[model samples]
Target: MSADSKESSVRLIITGRVQGVWYRAWFMEKAINLALSGWIRNLNDGSVEAVVSGLRENVEEMKKTSWSGPPLAKVDNIDVGIYKEKIVNSGFRQLPTK
Candidate 1:
């Protein structure tokens, strides 16, 4: 498929008081609700990282919402990365801390 019309995918690294919180779990639920597929995990630097794939709007919405996170989270920043890969629907998951 052409890159322009391919599915959208985003790699987000969320910083701040995100660990020890329910961020990963909550993000998984939200991603699923948006019918997205990808993986989420805690970074060794006390940040949260996720690679979600779905429609452009859904992915963008989720990315915006990630900055706020769950009620207990104190998100400071969310870094988005650009990658070259097709988004395959593989279902969302929470992975071990990296």
Candidate 2:
């Protein structure tokens, strides 16, 4: 599928002070606002990882938003990868830290 086409999933790895800053909650809010389906969680490496699925524009917006997280969050870098899958259909969620 083209970049502009509606995507089903977008995996992201956000680094920096993303953990312990309500980043997961903030991300869930953003995803819900965009009517996206996905989940956010803190990784064992102190980074935040997420997989969002929705319209192309919404997923793109989510990726952009990850660069500038919640006001208390200091996002250093955001890595994004898009994928075409059928594993997402639920609403946004803030997963437990791993």
TM-score of each: 0.91, 0.86
Segments of candidate 2 deviating more than 4 angstroms = 1-5
Best by lDDT: 1
Instruction: List model 1 lDDT by residue over 1-98, tens digit each.
Output: 34785468889999999999899999999999999999999989899889998888898899888887889999999899864576568899989988
| Runs of candidate 1 exceeding 4 Å displacement | 1-3
Clash pairs (backbone) in predicted model 2: none
Backbone clashes, each candidate: 0, 0
